[model samples]
Target: MSVPVNGGDLVVSRLSSAAPSAPTAIALHGITGNGWAWLPVAAGLFGRMSLWAPDLRGRAASRLVGPPYGLGTHADDVIALMDHLELERAVLIGHSMGAWVGSLVAARHPDRVSSLVLVDGGLGTAMPSWVDPDLFMYAVLGPAIQRLGMTFPSPADYLAYWAFHPGLGPTLAGPTGHLVRHYLTRDLVQERGGWRSSCVLDAVRADGSALLDDEEVLTSPQASIGHGIPVSLLWAPRGALNQPMGLYGGAWPPWRPLPEGITAERVPDANHYTVIFDPPAVRQVVSRLLAAAAR
Candidate 1:
């Protein structure tokens, strides 16, 4: 399903439930990810909640969405999606950059959200002064963003490429690999020589810049209204590269004081990618998401 917005129609992937009262959940993927990345989570839901994961505004099927890319714009798109769906309120679930955008949605339109689940993201990174401000995006995203420029000879080749990702490779080879394989396949588009990811490189950069420059988006909602909506931050200890430290480094997002209604909990043995792609981690995320909705 898609919600028509100014730039373009926001594409969404849905896993429906038979139960009439199944709570609706809108999921947002990571910066370089697409809606299908939530496949494992959807499957884990087992029809408990109707889940909809959008391609956001500039990734996958929504790649053609024009400029004005940032968390705020993304949040607006989400709200438009809700309006189109005629859903008065829903549970907001986000991962990585999506989590940041979800935070904005809950803060700006608290009445439209029941609760929020931030998986392995949504916290501000503690960038050091030594790190060049201009290079912070490159520093944080590293190869994940760099992969946009890469090309693979064929769909099979592209599948093999992600099968080798440092942190996600193993998960792509595991139980839910087929689901992730579908997600990766959707990310591919045939070019002259090979297939390249559908994500717009410039959009990714703009999003990274927003996250790096804005502290209030992450801390502001809490700073002001306290977001009355229940929020949970499920973090992973391992980074995107399978490193010991995650996005917040060795320490968590408590570089500053935490907000009143939000709480953080660490997910053991899961990295940035594994936190969703891996089966056990997917189950954990879904359970937490349901719990947040029940709140």
Candidate 2:
């Protein structure tokens, strides 16, 4: 269902179960992702907790919601979503850029966030100074960012386009094919020429810049040991393109090490996108969130 918020109506997917008093988990998708991207998580947590996944402000059905979009706005949008849901507090599960947004929300609206489950994001992805920012983003994100400008004649066409992605393509023919297909088809809508991705390029660029600019939130005293809210990280062992290397070269960030109290786990044999969709990774994520809820 679409609910009106600051910029426009935010599209949300509600996945509920029979569990009484089940905790509500608000899911934030990555930069080019939308509500449906969390389908695997919803399935993984079936009958355990309810999930509310939103399209943010500039992706998929929420594409019409224009800027002043950035990390701050995304966090406010999430808080607005919580208010609409009448949720006093909920677990915030974020992936990639969503993890960054979730961190800000926890910092800005402490009472509303019970805990944080950051999946392959929030701690900050590597951004080398010698490499051009835009080029680097494109290189890391690949088809996720590239498909925004292209058009496809059909959903199959769109899926076919994604078939070339190094990390995504090899898995499409495996047991996880259906999950991969769902990800490719989620935000596609018919255009005058053909079908086009609903992701907003400008909003993505803004959020990307915000991720690079914001370091205070990651290392601030309030977000670390000083804060009461518990934070945990779930990361993929490999890089975005399914490379042998991890995001931080299998090391921690130099700008700020993970705080004393926070716990982190690396999901082996997974990459940026698969960390959310792969069955083993999804199970790990659900287990962690459920564990956090128990706390």
Candidate 3:
């Protein structure tokens, strides 16, 4: 459902198994993705936790607002949503860009977040200075943009396009294909003749520079909050972005070293995307977070 916050509508989807008393886990998806991306993991964990996944502004179903789509703005949006829902404190789980925003929220608004599960991100690493934001956007968001550009002749065609994503290929081949198609088609708009993606590409491009700046800010020591809250960092072992041979050269950022209080876990035999979507992998990370929170 859409809730008005900061002059913009936040699109939030809640998944619960039986009752309202279930522990709530707030999830955040990466760039070019939305709340739907978390459904698989949410379903697995919903038996024990009520999951609330929201599409951030400028993406998916969320309403696009003013400029400065940096970490601070995204974190504030989350806090506003938490207040609207009257959630005193909830576990915050974020992936990729969402992880960065989650870190900012944990650091700035400590009381609102009880614990953090950073899936395949939030190692506090900085991108190199030479990389241009536009180029980075194309590389990172290319697959999603390509899916958006297609004019599917039929529902099957659209499903075919989605099933081919390298990240989802193996998982989408059988029964899981049905699940993936359901979520993808749920967001498609039927125009005069064909299907169109609901995501706003222009709005996503508008804040390209801001995303880069936010990454830099996150890597800075100033963004660090001293050791009190527990943080769980889940890193992808085979992701293109974090691969040893890639641009960053597998080096962790100097400014944002693993804090003394945070626990880090590396997901073996998975890329950035699968680390979150794969059921077993996701459960492993969630188990770690729950265990850490218990301590």
Model 3: lDDT of residue 176: 42
Comparing candidate 1 with candidate 2, which one achieves the higher lDDT?
A: 1
lDDT of each: 0.81, 0.80, 0.66
TM-score of decoy 3? 0.83
Ranking by TM-score: 1, 2, 3
lDDT of 1 by residue, 150-268 (tens): 99899998888777778888887789999989988988888799899998877877787777767757564463237577888888888887888887554555343555667777777
Instruction: Give the clashing residue pairs of candidate 3, or none.
Output: none
**Model number with the top lDDT:** 1
- Over 4 Å off in model 3, which ranges? 17-21, 63-68, 128-130, 148-150, 174-176, 206-208, 215-217, 220-227, 240-257, 292-295
> Model 3 over residues 13-73: C-alpha lDDT tens digits?
8854436776677888776677777777766675677778887876657745534455567
Q: In model 1, which runs have C-alpha deviations exceeding 4 angstroms?
A: 125-134, 220-225, 249-257
| 26 Cα displacement, candidate 2 (Å) | 0.4
Error of 3 at 291 (Å): 2.8
